[model samples]
Target: MILTTKSQFQSLIFTGTNGEYIAHYSHWSLRSVFQPIFGHNNILVGLEALVRIEDVHGESIRPDLFFSSTDISIKDKVNIDKLSRVIHIRNFAISEYKNLKLFLNILPSVSEYFALSDINTCLLSNRLKELQIDRSQIVMEIVELNANNEYLFVEAIKRLSQAGYCIAIDDFGACASTIERVKSIQPDIIKLDRGLLLEHFSGESNRLLEGIKMARALGAQIIVEGIETKEHLQAMETLDLDMFQGFYLATPQPILSCISNAV
Candidate 1:
């Protein structure tokens, strides 16, 4: 008897009828939730697409767990990343908030694949066009997890930036190598890790302030994540941070027709 759980089933890589290795998540019931990024005066400047997956039983599965449970090979990981981007763009196109910029997370490894050739560039551009999304409206947020190949990662970011996609270094301060990454990639935006806010109450603002200054010096806009409380908002009010996203301002949800439906 083959005992298969949903996580296990979703992790299995199989050869499709077309003789290509298909990522399990590509066929899974996946949807995207948009989290609004606010600028000064609480104006909505952009929306970040957060992916959600549902099990066969209709239960919500956390994305982190979904990805971590799957021992996906590098190739399949790249394929899954591409599929997720397509889904996000498709959903954004059909939604009423198509006017705002859409932020999409891309794994550094997957980005390297995109940097490999002009064909890949055209492929993504065509995909966005098919969904009526402009390439310029997409902000590629490169996730730094296991981004060991600095040379490849930097080159990939350069290629993508040249192709007109705004590059952002996601989860800054989450690791020590982030500073070097910021210097090398020179991303258009730097998102401070949510962990920094946890330390704000302890009166440790030096590091956070320094990070903001460094990003500004590099000609990058600063965005702070995880602002869930009024105190958190107060703590960040004096900073030069350009954008904010978290539970306090708004939470991730499907963009409904009316403004009152926002989370």
Candidate 2:
């Protein structure tokens, strides 16, 4: 097994997949891939953890569909979400990119799990300590939350931040992830959604630019995602954006291979 933690192995959260650690949930196999985030002048600043899923027969599964499907129970979602973060942190802790921030996504629907469990959150903190990784190098990015789960989401984010991890509000301006979320969560970073970027290119007013201004005023660093073209990046350069991510720069790749190359 790639995992060294005795408790991790005992819980069966991970198993070796061709020398790389991967999570298993229900009938699907889960793996971690990292997409690099760049700053001005294409400087690599951070990496985002994205989950890749495969069915038992080895067919590729779209992660977005898997995550958004209502068929999966909330309990299962919570387990998979926790497993994803664990695997990403494990892979990152042993890699050359350990110096860069690792952005891990949190599903809002499962926010109650974190909101209610100090023991579980403490285990995560302990894992970081065992790996000799700095808490500040981790960024917990929470996705959009609906009204019903908003309070718990805030509590979860606060718990993580209080434990020394940086907080980020993911997919701002999409779904329910609105400006109100930014105010309530008060995240360290605000990730502008790609949809807003596309809207900008269509001459649909600079709402994305306005968002950057608002986030900056709130003392939050801005990361413009979906810079799919030179023009898109150019638009961001005109603003005071802090980081960028999209296909134009690089695509997500298996964490094992990425860290190997970096080594």
Candidate 3:
């Protein structure tokens, strides 16, 4: 069943036959900040919801460290992912930029938890419908930490795609997966890893251009992440990237209206 209460922030507590699952927003000191994704002419096309956590003293907790420090069980990770989505949808529902697409990150392995009879899947689907968030507008960015289970990942992508959510391969170039993996999944979008732009590889520009072309030819859009300077932006201009996201364009913020000022 679905139950929620407001402490310091709204806490969504979902219980299934399995046991109690708590999305403790206040308990975890969790918040979601959105980074705007821009297309041609500096037009805002989407926003990626990034989770931020703070300590008791209101000190910021790095997301990576937060996850690493907590329980890494698949169930716990899935619960946190669900909580993030709920908050993002709730925030986006109240925002003026409802038309813009919302990109939500998901662990590639988390998909394995979403069986056909999964209660969490049902809850998530119901929540999305309740919020009136179109599935087409929500891009599920699959973060590839391990690529050994190609079959599992492919199956998960299929399920998500069939449910009408656009799939994206996040941190594409830096992932363990190869172009063969990209061809196998054929996601709706592929985000170039920030490392590719930060550390110059031999013929990095040419390599990126080729990569962009390859993704486009496969019917996927290319988004270059971490474009933090004019040089970065200028360097990508020649590649005809479908979208760009980085601190140079706009830092992740709590409000969508603030994005206009930043951009």
Q: Pick the candidate with the highest TM-score.
A: 2
Model 3 Cα shift for residue 151 (angstroms): 2.8
Clashing pairs in 3: none
Off by over 4 Å in 2: 1-18, 119-121, 145-148, 258-263
lDDT of 2 by residue, 71-108 (tens): 97666666677778888888787667888899998887
Q: Please tell me which predicted candidate would have the highest lDDT against the true structure.
A: 2
Higher-lDDT candidate of 2 and 3: 2
How many residue pairs of model 1 clash at the backbone? Answer: 0
Candidate 2: the clashing residue pairs are: none
After superposition, the stretches of candidate 1 with alpha carbons farther than 4 Å from their true spots are: 1-27, 55-59, 68-70, 119-121, 257-260
Q: After superposition on all CA atoms, what RMSD does each candidate show versus the true structure?
A: 7.1, 3.5, 6.0
Stretches of candidate 3 off by over 4 Å are 1-27, 55-57, 68-71, 115-121, 147-149, 199-203
Give the alpha carbon lDDT tens digit for every residue of 118-141 in model 1.
733455676677677777888999
Q: Which candidate, 1 or 2, would have the higher lDDT against the true structure? A: 2
| Sort order, lDDT high to low | 2, 1, 3
lDDT of 3 by residue, 20-43 (tens): 122344345556678999999999
